[model samples]
Every structure is written in C-alpha cells, then in structure tokens.
Target chain A: MVVLLLTILQGGMAYRQQAIHGLAVTGLSDQITWGLYIGNFTFFVGVAAAAVILIIPAYLFHRREMRRVTLLGECLAVAAVVVALLFVTVDLGQPLRIWHALPFLGKLNFPTSILAWDMVVLTFYLLINILLLWYLLYKKFCHHTLQVKHYFPLIIVAIILGLSIHTVTAFMLSGNPSRPFWHTAILAPRFIASAFAAGAALMIITFQILHRFSRFRLSKGLIREVALIMAFSQFISLFLLGSEFYTALYRHTAQHSSAVLLYWGTTGSEGLTTAIYLALSASLIGVVILMVRSWREHVPLLNLASVLIFFAIWMEKGIGLVVPGFTPTPLGEIAHYSPTTIEIQVTVGIWAVGAMIFTILARITIAIEYGHLKAIK
Target chain B: MANSRSTRRGFLKGTVAIATLTTATLASSSQSDEPTAFADSIASFLQDHYQRMSKDEIGELLARSERRAKREHGVDIKCHNTSAITGVTFGYALNLSKCKGTRRCVEACVTENNCSRNSNMENIRVLSLPEGTRDLNQSDHYYGVEQKVPEAGRWYLPVQCHQCDEPACVQACPVEATWKEADGIVVIDYDWCIGCRNCAVACPYWARHFNWSKPNLPAKEINKNTHYLGNRPRMAGVMEKCTFCIQRTRKGHLPACQEACPTGARVFGNLLDPASEIRYILENKNVFRLKEEQGTQPNFWYYTDV
Candidate 1:
C-alpha cells in the first residue's frame, strides 16, 4: 500500500514536471524520440493478447477446472490495457491534445494510419474483455449458473479481438518501412508467440499468489498443464528469434545492420547487446528446465522458471526491441538512449497503477467466489 | 457485481471532474495575461482544424497569431497562411557536382526559419561522403576542420525535406496533422499535432525534427516573414520541417537556402512551367531521387552536370 501511494505521488510529480518543462525533461531527443514508455506499451499489448490462452482452455477445450481462473486472465487483460493506454498518454508531448484523435470531434485517419487502427482495436478489445468479465462475474455472484450459449459467443469474439490487438500493434511497427529492424513479415507471429509465453508465465505467478493469499484453489494438475503450454510457446518464441537473427545476419545489407548492432553491439558500447544475450540465455535455461518433468513438477522450480520467463520476455520485448530500432538512426548516426530518472519514475508509476487495478479486481472476484459479496440484481 | 457498478460510476465521475478542473485551470491561467493575449489563447484553443476553418476564420487566426508574436517576442512579424497557387506545383533540383560543402545554406536556413539557436536545429544537413559513393550510411555532417571545400575527393550532399508526392510522413500522422500541400510542399499543423513523432520516424530522409524544448532565438535574430504552415516560430513538443520556404516561394522568391548557395547548385521553379529550370533539368539531366525504391515520388531531384 505504501509503495503504491509513493509510486502515485512520484508519478504525479513526474507528470507535472513533464507538463511544465516539456519532453526535454525526458531522455528522449530528436534522434531517439520514443523510449521506455513506447517499449512498455508494446509489452503490455502482448500481455492483453495472451489472455486468449485462459479462454481457450476454459471455453474451447471445456476444461471444467480452468473455468474458475479464466476471469483472472480477463482481469489481467483489463489491467494490461490500462497500462498500455497510460504509457501512450504519458509519451505524448501534448497529452491534452489527445482529443485530436477522437473519432467524431477530432480527425482520425482511420484507413491510412496504422496508429489509428491500433487505437480503435486496443480500445475495443479492452471494452470486450471488461464487459465479458463483468457479465460472467455478475451471473456467478447472483447465484445463477452461466449459460454457455450466451458467453460462448462473447468468448469467441474476445479470442479474435485479443489476437487482433497484438497483430495490429505489430502491423503498426512493421508498417514503418523506414525502420528496417521492425519491417518484417515475421514480427506478428513472433509477437504472438512471445506474448503467449509471457502471458501464461504471468498467469502462473498470479495463480500461485492468489492461492496463497485467498480462498482460491487451482485444480491439482492445472499448474503443470499451464507450464507445459508456456514451455512450448517459449520454444516457438526462441525459434522465431533464431529465424530473425539468421535472416538479418545472412542477408548482410545496410538495412539489416540495425539487427546486427542490436544482437552484437558496435565497437563503442556493448551494454544493450550484452543485455539481450543475457535475456536470451535466461529464456533458454528456463525452457530447458521446464522440459524436464522432474523440475516442472516441483513447485519452487516451476515458479523459478516462470519468473525467468517473465523477465526474459520483458527485457527482450521492451528495451531489447525498441532502443536498437532507433540506435543507428535513419541517417546512420548512433545516438544512445538510457531512460532518465523522470522517465523511470513515470514508468514504474504506470505499472503500479496497473497492479493496483488488478489487485482490487482480483480481491472483488475472490469475495464473490466465496459468497462474501452479494449481487445487487 | 454491484461493487463493480459503483466503481464504474465513480471512475466516470472522477474522469469528468478531472477534465473540468484541468480546463478551468487552463482558462484561468491564461486569464492572468493581457486581455488581448487571453482572447488569442481562447481563439487558438477553440480554433478549427486548418481544412475545416473558413477563410475569414483563418485570416483572423493569422492576424491574432501575428499580434501574439509582437506581444510576446516584440517582433513585427508578417503571418501569411498563403493558399497554394493553382497550376504551380514547385520542384527543386540540386547539381550535386557543384556543391562545395560550404554549409552556408545551413546557416541561412537557421536564420531565415528562426530555428532553435540553442538546440542548433537546422533544416539542411550538408553531408560529406566519399567520392563516387552513393551510400548515405558512410556520410558525415560534422566533417573535421580542414577549412576548405572539395577536400581529397570528398563530395557533399545537402539533404532536406524532399516534399514527396506520396510522403510517408503524411500517411504516418494519426490525426492528419501533416499533409502534402497542393503546391507539393509537405506541411504540419503545429497546433493540431499531438507530437507523437510518428511522422519523424516515418520520414526516411531524416528531414523532420521535434522540438524537445521551446525554440531559443534572440529577438533580433527572429525572421519577420513567417508562414503558418512553413517557418513560423514553433512551440515546444511539435514536429517541424523544411517547407521549401513556403512564405518566400509562394510570393515569387527563391528559398533562402537556394539563394544562399555560394555556387548556383540549388534550383527551384514551378514544375508546371514548361520552360522552368527544374523542368529543364529533369528533361535533360540524368537526374535521380534519394531512395527512389521507397516509392515516395519526391519532387526534389539531384543530378551532376559531368
């Protein structure tokens, strides 16, 4: 609670500074404009998309045990979307002018602008997840059994919307022909693969926490089942990463040099390159551990692998992806970027806000599950 | 479920209250300024988008902007939001063989455009590349202090906004804040721009720049002739780029960089004019555009009279 409050206070102060001093207060410059905020936005969009994993098992596979925790995944989606939107809001130089992108009141370049598509799709997906989760939780709280027919349609819509959110975001980045690092046919698949790996890993961690703190109990075999899904998804993620490396390095054009620099730093600095290597190594180790049935069955080892997977994806998709795209800028200038103090504060604060939302929603859901709260209807 | 309902209601109320507070604070803060300044601020805040505004509204906004400039910076500025001349799409051709890497055009651009002196923001970048090499990756804008032009087979390439017919920056803008003018110049609506800098990333030429801080130009150095879509003093946190000196070019004058070139290397003329210099160069010379494979269809061209 104290940490959350402190984060909010710090975030408010940083926001005030940004509003008064302009974007110059941040580490962003003309050469390296988008930074940590955009990176976080990209990461959270994947998290939201990964919610489909829970829905698939619960709705499609008809795994009765998975039904209880499916709402948890939807709640996670809501929080992730909130954070993603907040990152965009903070990144804007004129946050107040956001109404300029409004549908009717301001100009929204719908077909032309990929960003416009991203805005609409992300908002729609958020609304869908929120409404679906609320409807399900309400029905349960009112002592009414869920009619699968009613929710089955919503679940299908959510699954499609969830996948589209990340795919659209990938399109947003890859649409920029100028940035060779992002302009690839493989980016969308890689995004989904990594998103599933990270999202499932996060669900594992959240489930463990809820089981410990509340009356919530996971089915006997659910953790290992989810871990198996996470491990396979991690394998796919790694395969995609390898393919990207092969294409970039083998083609050996000036355009592909950004990838080379990202994976193996230039002569001057190897900080980012080393960081990416560490993340890749961590992911590889985690995947190997998960493949071993003995380790996967062990709760502590499983939790450890989950944490590593989360960290690996966060670092890989966050700084490892965004910064290198701009490092050797279009003009072939190497402008290094490190997040400033103010930027870090704002980012942490946004994460805190998301966590708070998730916590509140999860607590309420648990209360309803235990018959501690009554539905007004 | 009831708890969720209450929470949703509270969230909506909180959002409205915050919006109201912010708007009220913004209005009250501007009220502390001079009455005319307050009026100008309100007019600017409520100003319609460029395409939607009536001619009279545009004229009034421009006049008010001029007044604001005088009041704030103590400069007698001419704020002209000139409409594009029909049948006069501008084109530029640069004779690369003649460019001497003097960088005089860069200095002229900064002065004429009132660019940020403190940030050293200049529209034009005169890059010194290896002779007989077209690879822009090996170029450097900051050459050593050799103090002479055309040093040891090094050729200069001055790059600026190409003002492409199919500009990527225009398409990348989420709010249509930037667009290609009818006269082949790509311009940005400074007020309407949310400063996402997506256009900056989309521009392959490295032409666009974002104002990280308010531009710092001395009062005496401020250019009096300003165009609303061109070289007006830009606010902080917005995108700006070269507009072929829209104010000058629209009024039958050469751009500052073209005029400032020591050699007659830069050519600017109406593409629609059959006898214009730009058309003559295009017809006769082995002209090419940078990154033609990108399909940007740039109006700006380059050639060498070997």
Candidate 2:
C-alpha cells in the first residue's frame, strides 16, 4: 500500500510538471511524437483482447474446468482496458480538453476516423466485460443458478467486441499509408495471434498467484491446456513476424529503412537488434519447452516458459513494433527515442494502479464465491 | 439526538455556501480593476469553434484577439480568417533546378509564421540531396556553415505541406480539428486540437509541428500579420503546419516562401486559370508530385525549367 501510494504521488508530481511545462519534458519530439505511452496503450489493448481465449472455450465450448476461473480473465480484461485508457489519457498534450472528442457535446469524427472507431470499440468492450462479470458475480453471490439462455447472447457479443477492439486498433495503425512498416494486411491477424499468446501466458501466471493466495483451486491439466494454447499462438506469431522480416529484407526497397533500423543499426548504434534477438530467442526457447509433454508436466519449467513467453511478446509487440515504424520516419530521418525518467515513473505508476484494481476485484469475487460476502436482499 | 444532527448539518451547509460566495466575490473584485482583461478572459473561455461562429462573432473575436496580442506581446497584429475566393483553386510549382540549398525559404517561413524560436520548429525543410538520385536516405537538411552555397552538384528540395486534395491528416483527426478548405489548403483549429499528434504521423511529408513548449518568439520579432487558419500564434500543446500562407494568398499575394526566394524558383497562381503561371508550368513542364504512388494528389508540384 505504501509503495502504491508513493508511486502514485510520484506520478502525480510528474503529471503536474508535464501539465505546467508541456510535453517538452518527455523524450517525444516532433519527429517521433508518440512514445512509450502509446506503445503501452497498444500492448494493453492486445492484452484486453486476449480475454476472449478463456471466454470462448469456457463459455462456448462448455469446458467445466475452464468455467471455474473464467471470471479471472474478465477481471484482468477490465483492469487492462482501464490501464490502456489511462495511458492514452496521459499521452494527450491537452489532457483536460479531451472532451473535444466526446460525442454530441463535442465533435467526434465517427465512421470517418479509425481512431473514433477504436474509441467506440474499446469502451464497448470494457463495458461488456464489466457488466457480464458483475451479473455473474451477483448471481453467484445470491446463490442463484446462472441461466445460460439469459447471458449467452451477451457473452457472444462480448467475444466479438473483444476481437473488434484489437482489430480496430490495428486498423488505426495500418491505415496510415505513410508508414510502410505498419501498412500491411497481415497486421490485424498478427496482433490477434500475439495478443492470445501474451494473454494466455498472463492468465497462467495470474491463476498460479490466485491459487497460492486464495481458496481458488486450478488443476494441473487446466494449466497445461492454457499452455498448449499459448504454445500454438506463439508459433503463429513467430511465423508472421518471420514473414514480415522476410518481406522487408528480401525486397530491399527504399521503404526498407525502418526494417533495417529494426534489425540492424542505423549508423553507429546497433539499433533494436539486441531486443529483437532476445524476443526471438526467448520465444523459440519457450516454444521448444512447451512442445515437450514431459517438460510441460513439470510445474517449474511450465512457469519459467510462461514467464519467457510473456516477456518475449511484451518486448516484441511494445518497443520492437512501435519505435521502428517512426525511427526512420517516412521522410527518411533517424530520430532516436528512449523513454525519459518521467515516462518510466508514470508507466510504473499505471501498472501499480492496474495491479491494485485487479487484486481488489479478484479478492471480492473470491470472497463472494466462498460465501464470506453475502448479497443484500 | 436526530434534531441535533440535523441542526449541525444545516450549520455546515450554511458555512460552505458562505465560503463559496466569498471566494466568488474576491475573484470578481480582483478582475474588476481591468474590465477588458476580465472581458477578454470571459470571451476566450466562451469562444465558439470557427465554423459555428457567426460573422459578427468572428468580427468580435478578431478585435478581441488583436487586443490580447497587443496586451501580451506589445505588438499591434492583424489576425484575419479570410474565406476562400470562389473559382480560385491555389496551386504551386517549384523549379527544382533553380533551388540552391540556401535555406532562405525556411528562415522566411519561421519569421513569417512566428514559429517557436526556442524549439526551432520550421514548416519548411530544404533538403540537400545527391545528384541523379531521389533517395531521401542520402539527403541532409542540417547543412551547417558551408564555405559556399549550393555546394558542388548537391541539388536542393524544399518540402513543406503538400496541401493534398485528400489529406491524410484530415482523416486521422478524431475531432474535426483539422480539415481541408475549399481552396485546397489544409488548416487546423489550434484551440480545438487535443494534440494527439495522430495527424503528424499520418502525414507522408513531415509538415506538421507540435508546440512542445510555449513558443518563445521575441516581442519585436513576432509577425503582426497573422491568420487564424494560417500563421497565427498557437498555444502550447497544439498542432501547427503550413497553410499555404492563407492570409496572403487569399488577398492575391504569394506565400512568404515564394516571395522570399531569391532564385525565382517558386511559381504560385490559380490552378483554375489557364493563363496563370502555375497552370502554364503544369501544362508545359514535366512536373511530378512527391510520393505520387501514395495518391494524395497534392496541389504542390515540382518541375525543372532546365
């Protein structure tokens, strides 16, 4: 609690400094306008989208064991969407004047702007998860049986909305023809695949923590099932990544500057080559570990592989994907971007807030399940 | 006991109301010494978006803006928000062969637009590219202290806002803060912008600049002639770009860069008029737009009269 408070206080001070001095304090310049904030926004949006992996098989496929802990996925999604929204808010130059994008009271260029579509989809997805979870918890607390007929339709919609949120975000980036690195048809599918990989890996770690702390009992078989899903999704993600690298390096057009900057150094710097190599090697190692049945049964190796997969996807999707697209900007100039001290503080604060929210929500849900918390009549 | 609690609550409410009233009174009284300052503050807060404002409101806004400029910068400025003239679609043609990499246009644009001196934001980037190649990778804009101008076979290309017929920046704005005018120039409503910088990334040409800090132009050096959609002083945390010098071009004058060019390389005139210099150059010269395959269809073109 003290740590969270101190981080929040530090973030508050940084925010105040940003508000007074403007965005000049951050590493962002005119050349590379969006930085760590937007990168985190993109990553968290994918995390939110990944909630469907648990929802789909558990609810749609009628997996009884998976249904036991599906609420955990929903809770994580809600927390992630909240964090994503906060990142975008902090990224804005005029944070107070954000009402300009509000519907009706202000001008919202809907249908025409992909960003407007993103705003709609992300909000709708957040609301769907929150309401669905609330309804389920309410029924559970009241000792009433959940009527599938009543909630199934909402779940279906939530699933579609979850997919749309990440797809729309990909469209927002890919729609910019100016940036060749982001302008690709395969980007949306790649985003979904990587999202599922990271999302499943995160849920594995989360469930482990939950099991250790609470009365929530998750079976080894269930963890292995999620691990299998993670392994498959990571394979697809790695394949798509390899395809992108192949296309960029094979053709070697004038548009290859961004890709070169990502794989190799620009002039003197080794660029993000080390980061890319780490992500690739970790993912390969994770896939190899998960592929072996004997190793997957071992809890320690499973946890280690999950951690590796999580970090691999995070590095690949966060800095590896965003920074290169802007480094050798469309006009071909190298403007290096490294997150400043203020950005790092605020990012950590946001993560701490997210963790707090998830912990509280999970605790309440667990208490209700165990009948320690009663529903008032 | 209930009666006592109700009485205490009433006393607390009364105290809060009195405190609020006293604060309001003090705030109004402080501003009462200068009526114009108070009025300006109120007007600024209540100012409508440019499209929603009536003619009379615009007139009042311009007058108030002039007053604010004089009060803030001690400069008598003219801020015009001119409507586009019918039958005059503005176009530009640059003679690339004549450009000497002097960067005179860049300096002229900074001075004319009153761009931030401290941040060094300029709308124009005069690139010195190698001969017989259009590769942007080999181009350099920061050619410092050259012993001579137009150094040995390095041709110059001055890139500004292309003012596309279908601008990507306009489509990227979530709020309709930036848009294309009828005369083919893209303009931004600085006050309405949320400063997401989505438009900056959308633009193929790096034309848009964000005010990272409060623009630090000296009061004496600040350009007095401004346009609301063109070269007006913008607030920190807003997007600004080249607007084809809307203030001057609407009044049948060339853009500042065109006028400032010593080589007579830039030609600006109405695209609709066949007799205009821009149209003549378009019909006669082999002209091309930058990033032509992207299909932004920029009104600005490049040609060589060699």
Candidate 3:
C-alpha cells in the first residue's frame, strides 16, 4: 500500500511536470514521436480484449465452471481498459484539451480517423463491461440470480466489442502507411492472438492468488480449462511471430529493416534486440510448459508458466513492437528513445492504480459471492 | 470499488489543479506587463475550432493571438485569418541540376515561420544523398554540417510538406485540427490540435513536428506578420508544420523558401494556370514526386533539367 501510494505520488508529480513543460519531459522526439506510453497502451488494450477469451466459452459454449468465473475476467477487463485509457491520457501533449475531440462540442474526424474509431470502441467496451459488472453485482447484492434473458444480448455485444477494441487499436497502428513496420494486414490477428495469451496468463495468476489467499473456492478444473486456452493462444501467438519474422527477414527488404533492427543490431545501434530475444525465449519456455497436459495441470508449474507468458507478451508488445516501428524514422534518421524518469514513474503509477482497482473489485466480487457482504432488506 | 472510485476522483481533481496551475504560470510568465487576465485565458482555452467558428469569432481569436504574441515575444505581430484565393491551386517544382544544399531556405523558413529555436523544430529537412539514387534509407538528413554546398558526387533533396490533395496527416488527425486549404496548402489549426502526434506518424514526408517545449522565439527575431493556420506563434503542446507559407502564398507573395533560394531552382505558381512556370515545367520536365507509389498526389514535384 505504501509502495502504491509512493508510486502514485511520484507519478502525479511527474505528470504535473509533463503537463506544464509538455512532452519534452518524455524521451519522445520529432523522429520517434510515440514511445513508452503508447506501447503500454497497445499492450493493455490486448489484455482488456482477452476478457472475451473467458466470455466466449462461458456464455457461448455454456461451460458451467467458466460461467462462474467469467465475472472475474470482466473485472480484469474493466481495470485493463482503465489503464489503457490512462496511458493514452498521459501520452497526450495537451491532455486537458481532449474535449476538442468530443462528438458534438468538438470536431471528431469519425469515419475518416482510425484514432477516433479506436476511442469510440474502447470507451464502449469499458461501458459494456461496467454495465455487465453492475448488473451482476446488483443482482447478487439483492440475493437474486441473474436472468439469462436480460444479459444474453449484452453478452453477445460484449463478445463482439472485446474483439473490436483491440482490432481497432491494431487498425490505428496499421492505418499509418508511413510507418512500414506497423502497416501490415496481419497486425490485427497478431494482436488478438497475443492478447489472449497474455490475458489468460494474467487470469491464471490472479485466480491462483485468489484461491490461495481468499475464501473464494475456485476449482482447479476451472484453472486447468483456462490454461488450455492460454496454451492454445500462446501457440498461435508464437506461430504468428515466427511467420512475421520469416516474411520480414527473408529478402531483408528496406521496409523490413525494422524487424531486423528489432531482432538484431542495425546501423551500429542495438535497439530492443536484447528485450526481443528475452521475450521470445520466455514465450517459448512458457508455451512448452503449458502445452504439456501433465505440466499445465500442476499448480506451481501453471503459475510459473503464467508469469513467464505474461512478462513475455508485455515485453513483446511494449518494447519489441512499438519502439522498432519508429527506430529508422520516416526520414531514415536513427533516433533513440528511452523513457525519462518521469515517463517511467507515470507508467508504473498507472499500472499500480489498475492493479489496485482489480484487487478491490475482485474482493467485492468474492465477498458478494461468498455471502460475507449481504444487502439488508 | 467505492474506495477506488474516490481515488479516481481525487486523481482527476489533482490533474485539474495541475492544469490550472500550469495555465496560471503561462499567463504570469507571458503577461508580465498586464495584470493576469484569467477570464481572457479561459476564453482562449474554450475557443472553438477554426472551421466551426464564425467570422466574428475568428476575428476575436486573431486579436487574442496578437495580444498573446505581443505579451509573449514582445513583438507586435499582425495575426490574420487569411482565406485562400479563389481558383488558385498552388504547385511547386524544383530543378535538381542547378540546386545546391546551402540551407538558406531552411534558415529562412525557421525565421519566417517562428519555429522553436530551443528544439530546432524546423519543418524542412534537406536530405543529402549520393548521386544516382532514390534510396531514402541511404539518405543522410543531417549531412554537410560544415562541408561546402554541392559536394562532389552528392545531391541535395530539400523536403517539406508536399501539400497532398489527400493528405494522410489530415486523415490521421482525430480532431480534424488539420485540413487542406482551397489553395492546396495543408494547414493545422494550432489551437485546435490535441498534440497526439498521430499526424506525424501518418505523414510520409516527416512533414509534421510537435512542439516539445514552449516555442522560444527571440523578441528581435519574431516575425511581425502571422496567419492563423500558418506561421502564428504555437503553444508548448501542439502540432505545427509547413503550410507552404499559407500567409504569403494566399496573398500573392512567394514562400520564404522560394524567395530565399539563391539558385532560382524553385518554381512556385498556380498549377491550374496553363501558362504558369510550374505547369509548364510539369508538361515539359521529367517530373516526379517522392514516394509516388504511396499515391499521396503531392503538389510539390522535382525534375532534372535535361
């Protein structure tokens, strides 16, 4: 709690400096404009979208065990979305002037701007999850089981929304034809695949912690089922990564230099090469462990695999992906970007806030589920 | 959940306080002669987008900008909202043979556009590439710092905003803060810009620049003439770029770069005019644009004087 407070305080202070002095507080430059904040935003959007990995089987396939734990995934989604939004807020050079993009009051280039679309989809996804959580918690508070008819349509909408929020984000990145590294048709699928891998890994860790520390009697069978999904998604994520690497590095075209620059040192500058290798190594190890049925079912092994998978995806999406896209900038200038102390503090603070939100929401959820917190008539 | 809610609210309140404090600092620092006009600052803060505003609103905004400039730079800048002239489609064609990368155009642009000196945020970048090559990856944007112009077997390509008819920067801007004028110059409403820098990513030419710090325009070097969407003094956090010197071009004056070019290699005139030099060059010369495969339809062209 003290660490969290200190992080927030430091972030708040740094944020003030950033706001007052502008993005100069960041390591971002005219050459490589988007940096640490945007990279994290992209990763978290995937994590948020991963909620559907839980929702799909729970509602669509009618898995009884998954249904009970779907709300936990929704809570995670809510927190992830909040964190994603905060990252964007902190990245903006003029955060207070965001109202300038409001629909009626300001001019939003809606149909044309992929960014505007991303904003809409992300907000809508957040609201949908919030509404779902509220209805479920409210019904639980009133000692009433949920009526399927009331939430059936909402669930369908959320499932589609979950896919879209990340897809739109991918589009936002890929829409920039100028940034050759991000401009790929395969980006959206890659995002979804990686999101599920990371998202399910996070869920496994959270569930294990909950079962160990709290009165929430979550079944091991439920965790094993989630591990299956995580394993499958992680496999797909690795496959996509391999395919992209092969395609980008085969002929080593000029446009594909970003991939080379990311995976290996280029132009006497080793940018994110170490991080990329670390991510790939972790991902491979995690996938191998999770793919084995005997290994995945083991609680300790499952927890280890989850942590590794989560960290790998975070590094892959954050440094390995976003930074390389801008390394040899449009003008062929190799500009280096390393987040300033202010940027790192702000990022850590936002992550802490997200984790705190998830913890509180999970606690309330557990209390309501276990009948420890009941509404008085 | 309730505890988290209060914390979020507290976070917002803190941000608001910080924003107000920063604005107060800006006002105090800029308006030292006059008492701090919080109401005026607030009014400017709540100002409408350039496209949505009435003529009266624009006039008021211009006046405010002038006042801000006078206070900030200690210069009486004539800020105007100059509309594009009718039936004029501006086109530029440069002759590569006669050109030498002297960087006079770059200096002229910075001085004329009131670019940030602290960050060296100039819109134009003169790329020096080896002879007989279109490979941008091999191009050096920061070459010939101390070397003489037109070095042996080296050629210069001065790139700025191409003023595309279908500008990617305009498309990428979430708030429509930027748009192409009737005269074919792509302009940014500095006040309306959210400083997301998506436009910078979208621009193929690396045309757009973000104000990383408060633009440091020395009082003596401040350009007295300014336009709303062109060379006006920008804030600390906004997007600015080459607008083909919209203030000068729309008023029948050559761009600062064109005027400063010693080799007389730059040709700027109406593309629609059949008799104009640019149109004549377009018809006669082996004209091409950078990254033509991107289909940006840039009005700026380059040709070899064969």
TM-score winner among the candidates?
A: 3
Candidate 1 lDDT, tens digit per residue, A1-377? Answer: 68897897899899888888888988888778788999899999999898898889888999877777888899999999999999999988777788778764567899799888889989999999999989988888898987899878889999999999899888888887888999999899999999999998999999988998888887658887788889889999999999999989987789987888887687654777888888999899899988898988888888888999999999998888887888677777777777889999899999999999999988988888878887776
lDDT of 1 at A332: 72
**TM-score (chain A only) of candidate 2:** 0.97
Candidate 3 residue lDDT tens string, A303-336: 8899999999999998778888986878777777
Residue B303, candidate 2: Cα error in Å is 0.4
Runs in model 3 lying further than 4 Å from the true structure: B1-36
- B90-120: candidate 3 lDDT, tens digit per residue: 9999888877998888999999999989576
lDDT of 1: 0.86
lDDT of 3 at B142: 76
**Greater-DockQ candidate between 2 and 3:** 3
The lDDT ranking, best first, is 3, 1, 2
What lDDT score belongs to each candidate, Candidate 1 first? 0.86, 0.84, 0.87
lDDT of 2 by residue, B1-306 (tens): 567545544553465456545555656857654335555654554345567566887787788777777777778899988889999898889999898877788888899888989576999888888898989878886887355778897888889999999888898999888999988889998877888899998999988999998888789998888888877777789999998889889988889999999999999889999899898899999999999887788889999976
As for candidate 3, its clashing pairs are none
User: By DockQ thresholds, what CAPRI class is model 3?
Assistant: acceptable
